[model samples]
Target: DMEIKNTNTIQYRSMVDKLIFLTNIRLDIAFVVPYVSKFMQTPQQTHLWAMKGILQYI
Candidate 1:
């Protein structure tokens, strides 16, 4: 699988950081949040999609 770097790096990182904070109260997302956070430095479109899905889940 090819991973394309996200152009909206700042936005992605910001959202992921928010998710990281959410993980404390939202136990269900604890696992997934860290998984997505791994890509924060170089998030791809897929990563952003995952973040959106997480937001929808919340």
Candidate 2:
């Protein structure tokens, strides 16, 4: 679990937005997207990595 303070807020927000948009059209990542999106305001490196993994899957 990575700390939220050290993670990139901008990138995390961007990715979460993208994932939310994608979730509207893609069902596969819907579950993970919401799980990770829960930390939108204060995301960690681990959350970012999880989002990256989902993005890579797509």
Candidate 3:
């Protein structure tokens, strides 16, 4: 995993939510952000790792 830093759940959800709002207008992060947000419901360590992967992709 990339030790690229981290975020708390509250911050994570907030970020992804904002990204979701952008999805309606912006075409960039639309797809990846929602897919990442899905894990916000129950984010585990592994989920965070996956999210990080998505982040890298974005």
Query: Evaluated with TM-score, which candidate comes out highest?
Result: 1
Error of 2 at 10 (Å): 0.9
What is the full ranking by lDDT, best candidate first? 1, 2, 3
Encode model 3's per-residue lDDT on 1-58: one tens digit a residue.
2333334565567767767786787787776876787877656677666656655665
Candidate 3 lDDT = 0.66
Using TM-score as the yardstick, the better of models 2 and 3 is 2
Residues 1-58, candidate 2: write the lDDT tens digits.
2444645877888888898898878988878877887888877678778878888999
Off by over 4 Å in 3: 1-7, 44-58
* Candidate 1 deviant stretches above 4 angstroms: 1-7
RMSD of each: 4.1, 3.6, 5.6
Candidate 2 Cα misplacement greater than 4 A, ranges? 1-7
Q: Among all windows of ten consecutive residues in candidate 1, which has the lowest summed lDDT?
A: 1-10
Residue 25, model 3: lDDT of 75
How do the candidates rank by TM-score, highest first?
1, 2, 3
Query: Between candidates 2 and 3, which one is better according to lDDT?
Result: 2
Where does the lowest 10-residue lDDT sum fall in candidate 2? 1-10
lDDT at 30, model 2: 78
Which residue pairs in candidate 3 have backbone atoms (N, alpha carbon, C) closer than 3 angstroms, thus clashing?
none
lDDT of each: 0.81, 0.80, 0.66
